[model samples]
Target: MSEEFTYATSEGPNGWTIWQVIGRIDVSTADEAYASGEEIVKGNEKIAIDLSTLEYISSAGLRVILRLNKLAKKSGHKLTVCGAYGMVKSVLKDSGMDVLLAAKESLDELS
Candidate 1:
């Protein structure tokens, strides 16, 4: 079965663009989500991702986030993720990416 994922972007305080991701992010939708993030990171200097609505994420999805985080750093932009909870946050913490990416408590922390 195919799952539906929604991705939207909005302006945050202090020039950061917040990308709100909803639904499950798995192999089926990881590429799309990653592309969306890449486009924003390419055009904006500050990017924040909100995962509050994200219900589930697979390793593929995590890879996409890691890639975007690396790209953001390489391009001299900042990438922050917030609102991760339960399994989503557990995966990140277990993989040690939580520290590597320097995830903030919220987008406001980035400011």
Candidate 2:
């Protein structure tokens, strides 16, 4: 399998933008992940990070998410996480990031 981590953005309902995270986010990619997500949150008022295609995320990845969340809050923007499944979902839940971030089970939940 490929080890590439990339992002795709699309307009979402409820005035939110969907930032789809594909591939893995670990120590090696965490910086890039944060940079990319920071840019997204800066440009949009509402963001929903869709992680359905995400395969893995390390603690570094979680840190990136948390930072983005804080950035959004400080900027008066809204940020939410959605579409997490399997190990990704488990990690978010186990780490309590799910509750802290108010992560949704699916993008539809945000809609």
Candidate 3:
């Protein structure tokens, strides 16, 4: 068995894509994360992953973020990480994903 997690996608202010992630994100759940995010980004120009509620993230989770970043860039969209705190923020910065996700301290900055 594997750990469980949950996520949700919604529209943010200014027509941005918002993905709210919760629980642990590891190898087993990376696919789900990717799929959900992929769909949320459809026909959207700005994407933001709300990680304030997320507890943990492994390399696999990082990969999911990277993939989203690539897709957004290829489509000429912007991807930002909104409210990434504690370890989640550290992981993004440590892996240098902050450059790709452009992790923002506030949701307002994400727009």
Candidate 4:
């Protein structure tokens, strides 16, 4: 069976957009997650990704996030990830993406 992933976007403080990702963000759903994030960043100067409900993520997902970070930099936008926990945070930390993406501790910390 194919796993389903859901990603939703909303307005954040100071008009920044927040993309709340739910479900597993693995190889099967990485593209959809990336596309959703891309659409939010297209017109906004700041974007936050909420990983509170995200259960799993793979290398493909990390690659997508890295690509988004680069795109955000070139477009003069800010990209931050919030609420990563357990294995999700471990993977990010292990891959050194936690540093590269500048993933923040929490939304409150960013505020």
Best by TM-score: 2
The CA lDDT of each predicted structure is: 0.87, 0.92, 0.84, 0.84
Q: Could you tell me how far off, in angstroms, the CA of residue 87 lies in candidate 3 after the best superposition? A: 1.2
Inter-residue clash pairs, candidate 2: none
- Stretches > 4 Å off in candidate 3: none
TM-scores of all models? 0.92, 0.96, 0.89, 0.92
Clashing pairs in 4: none
- lDDT tens per residue, model 3, 7-103: 8778888878888888878898889888888887666788888988898999999998888888988888888888988988898889888876677
Provide the RMSD of all predictions against the true structure, rounded to 1 decimal.
Answer: 1.8, 0.9, 2.2, 1.8
Ranking by TM-score: 2, 1, 4, 3
Give stretches of model 2 more than 4 Å off.
Answer: none
lDDT of 2: 0.92
Q: Residues 1-111, candidate 1: write the lDDT tens digits.
A: 227678889999989899999998899998898888899999999998898778888999899899999899999998889988988899889988898876776666758
Worst-scoring 10-residue span by lDDT in model 3: 1-10
- Report the C-alpha lDDT of model 4 over 25-111, residue by residue, as the tens digit: 888988888888788777788889888878888998898788888889999999899989998899999999888886777776666
Residue-level error in angstroms, candidate 3, position 111: 3.0
